[model samples]
Target: MKTPSAFYKPLAIGAPEPFREIPVSLERMIHFVPPHIEKMRAKVPDLIEKVDVVLGNLEDAIPADAKSDARNGFIQMARDNDFGSTGLWTRVNCLNSPWFLDDIVEIVGAVGEKLDVVMLPKVEGPWDIHYLDQLLAQLEAKDGLSKPILIHAILETAEGVKNVEQIAAASPRMHGMSLGPADLAASRGMKTTRVGGGHPDYAVLSDADDGGARAAYQQDLWHYTVGKMVDACLSYGIKPFYGPFGDFSDPAACESQFRNAFLMGCLGAWSLHPTQIGIAKKVFSPDAGEVEFARKILEAMPDGTGAVMIDGKMQDDATWKQAKVIFDLAKLVASKDADMAVIYGF
Candidate 1:
C-alpha cells in the first residue's frame, strides 16, 4: 500500500488538475459591521446558494474596535450555521499586524475545521507563507485536525509580485494566489483612485488615418500584472484568480473583465456585488457554441490522429487539447446545472 506521502507525490509536480476539482469557489469578501451580524446571517442563505464560496471579511473592512467582534461573530457563525459544501474561507489580518496572531489563534482554535482557506494579504516573500504554514501545522496538530487548512496569498505588493512563484511553491498548504489590484496599485504607485476593475487613464492610442492626428485611450493597467501572475501560478501548479471587479452596476464591463481573465487561463474572477455573480458564472462557464464545436471535434477525431480540416483550421493534437479545455469546463459546470448539461449535450 502506498503511503500518503507517496500517494500525493504525483499531484505535487505540476500535474494537470482534476477537472471540476475546484477546492473553493468564492465571490468577494463581504464586509459587515458588528451590529450587522444578524443582517449578514440573513444574507448568508442567499449567498451560499448563489456562490460556491463565501468568505467573511475580517481584515480590512471591519473597524478596529469591531475586529474582535467580527472575528468572534465569524467563529460563532461558523459554529452555528452550516455552509454545507460551499467552502467557508476568511481573509485574516496580515502577519505584521497586531491582530495577526490573535486572528489565527481564534479562527484555528475555534473553527479551524470549518475553514477552507485563510487568505493572507501583502505576502512579500516565501517567509510569510512559511510562517503561516508552520503555524497552521502546529494548530492542526494541537487541534487534532485531520485535514490541513489551505493558505492563499494575495499578490498585491511589488515584492509579493516579484516573488510570486516562490510564494506559490512555498508550502503544500499554499493552494492558490489572487491578484489584489487595489493594494497592488497603491504599492506600485499607480496614479489611480479607484479600488480595481478599470482605469480610464491607462489606454492606447489608435493611429490617425491620414496623418491628421493621433488619439490615445485607456487600457487595462492590470494586463501586465495579470499575465505575469497567471504565468507564475500556472508554473507552480496553482489556480490563478482575478481579485475583484469593483464596477458592480456595470455588468457588461464586469463580464468583459472576467472574460479576459477566463480567456487567459484564470480559474475565476471575484464578484463584489450579487449582480456580478451571474457575470462570472457566465464568463467562466464555456459557451454553448464552443462546447458544441469541441464535442464535434472529439467525435470527428476518435483516434486523436493527424491533422484534419475543420472550420478552415487544421484540427490535430494541439487543437484537440484546446477543444478539451472547453469540453472539460462544460462538463464541470454541467454537473451542477441540469439545464447546462442538456444545452451542452454532456
Candidate 2:
C-alpha cells in the first residue's frame, strides 16, 4: 500500500539529536482541586524554582466539574508569576473527548504566550498529531505569537506504539514522546495489575538441584514499548522520556526505573509525587564524579586529537563525544541551579 502524504517522509536514520537547546524536566503532574487553588498557588513559587518544567494537568485526575477552574487557575498562575527559564506546559483533554476543543481554545486564547508545550495523550498515529499541529499553528498565527507552540505525544495505544516513528516525524513542532504506561496497559490488555513497572508474576525460578532451568516469568511490562519508543525518537531527532513511576512510596524502585531510562539515553522521567522530583533530578543529571572526569577528558583531548587511556579504559574521539554529552548536561543543570556548579565542581 502507498504511504499517505502525511506519512511519506523518509525514515530518520541514526541517533536522534537533542530537539531543544535547553533540557526539559517536567514537574510531577499536578492534580487540580477547585477549593485547593490557593494551596496549589502557594506551592507554585517553590515548585517552579526547582523544576525545569511545570505542567498543569487538565485531564484524568481533575474532577469533571473543576476543569474550568483548573484552566483558569493555570491562566492566572501564568499571568501572576514569572517562571523565568522554567517551561510551562499543560496536558489537554484527548481529541476524542467533548472537552478537548474547549481545552485547546481556552488554553491557546488565554495563555498561549506563556505555555511552551501541549501534551497530547493516547496518540495513535501521525494523523492525530497532524490535526493538532494545524490547529496549533492557526491559533498561534491568530494570537500573533512569535514562537510556535510544541507538541508532546503520549505513546499509550497499540497503534501508537506501532506508528511512533511517523508521529514523531509528523511536524516540526513535535518535541518528544513519553511512555504512558497506564493507558497503554489497558489498551493492550496487559495482564499486570500495576500501572507501569515491574510485576512479581513476571519472574524466573530455578528447577530442583541438578535439574535444568527454563525461561520463566515476564520482565518489565513496558520495556519493549519503551525501547521501541526511544529508538523512534532517537531516529527522528527528538527527545524520549519515561512517563511516570506511579509507586509513590518506594523511592528506591523509582530511582532504579529512572536510572534504567537514563542509561538507555532518555533525557528525563516524569515525577508524579513531589518526593519523586528529587530522585528524577538526581538520576537524570550526570553525577559529580562523572562530570569532573568528562571535563578532564575534554582538557586532555583539547583539539579532539589522538586517543588516550583514562581509568583503564581507551579514551578516543568516540569517548570524547560521549564525555561531551555529560559535560553539556551538567552545564544545563548548573544554569538552572547556581549551587550545582559548586556541587559538581564545574
Candidate 3:
C-alpha cells in the first residue's frame, strides 16, 4: 500500500529539533490552570514546583464571556512569574471560535518568548496545525520574538485522530499531541457522558446462560485511538500525552488510566486537578526497582550488541535496547531532583 501523501513531507517554515547530549522531555504530569480564576494563578508558584508543566487555559475551561480576561490573564501570569524548569503552556480557543484569533495574536505577541508551548484544541487535520504554524511565524517576526513558539495539537476529533500521522509530522514546530477524550467522545457520538474514563455500559459482560453471575468488564474507550496516536508521535520523534481524567476522587481509576497510557508508550498524561498530579507523575516515572534491574542488565552487558547470561536468564540485544531506555530516563530524572539523584545512585 502506498504511504499517506502527508508522510515524509514536513510543513514549511519549521526546522527539525536538534539533538542534545542529554535529551530532556517532560513525560510526567501536566497541570492545568484556568487563567480566568484568580485562585488558579495564585497557585502557580506552588504548582510550578510540583508539576513538570503548568498550562494556563484560555479555551473550553474558560467561559465565552471571560475569554478575553483569560487570555490577558494567561499572558500576564507568564510575564509575572518565572517558570524555571516547569514549562508554561497555554491551551488556546479552538480555531473556529471568535476568541481564537485574538488568542493567537495577543498571547504570542506578548508572552510568546516566555511561553514554552501553545496548545491548539479541536484540531481537525494538518491544516489546522499549518494555520497555527504560519500565524506563529508571522507573529514571531512582527513581535521580534527571539524564539518561535511550539505547537501542541490536541487530538479530540474523529478527523484529527484519523489524520494524526499527518498532524504529528506537519511541522518541526510541532511539540507533541494530547488525547482529548471528552471532545473526541462528542465527535464520535459516543453514549457516555463521563470525561475520559471507562463507562460501565461501554464494557464487556459475562454470558447469561452459562455463567452463575454476570460481570461487567470495563475497557478503555480510547485504547485504539491512543495506540495509533503513540505510534504516530514516536514515528515523528515527537511526544504523545494522555489528556485529563475527570474522576478525580477515584484515585485508583485515575492511576489505572495513567498506567495504561504509560505502558502503551505515552510520554505522560495530563492532570486536571492537583489531586491527580501525584498519580500522573508516579505512573509516568520509571519504577525504582525496574530501573535498578535495567542498570544491572546494562552493567552485565557492557557490550550492547551481544547476548549474555545474567541470574539464569538470557539477555540479548533486544533487552539491552529496552534497558537503555530506562537508564536514560533514570539519569534524566535524577538530574532534576536531588532525591531521585540519590535513588538512582548518581
lDDT of 3 at 61: 70
Steric clash count of candidate 2: 2
The regions of model 3 sitting more than 4 angstroms off are 1-23, 206-211
Model 3, CA-based lDDT? 0.83
Give the Cα error of residue 345 in candidate 3, in Å. 2.2
Ranking by lDDT: 3, 2, 1
Q: Of the pair 1 and 2, which is ahead by lDDT?
A: 2
lDDT of 2 by residue, 169-247 (tens): 8876788888888888888888866766788787776565666656576466667888898899988778888888788
Candidate 2 regions with alpha-carbon error over 4 angstroms? 1-36, 206-208, 211-218
Candidate ranking under TM-score, highest first, comes to 3, 1, 2
TM-score on alpha carbons, each prediction: 0.87, 0.87, 0.91
**Candidate 1 per-residue C-alpha lDDT over 21-62 given as tens digits, one digit per residue, 9 for 90 to 100:** 335343322222232266776677677766766777777767
- What CA root-mean-square deviation does each model show from the true structure? 5.0, 5.5, 3.5
Which residue pairs clash in candidate 2? 28-271, 202-218
Please give the lDDT score at residue 20 for candidate 3.
Answer: 22
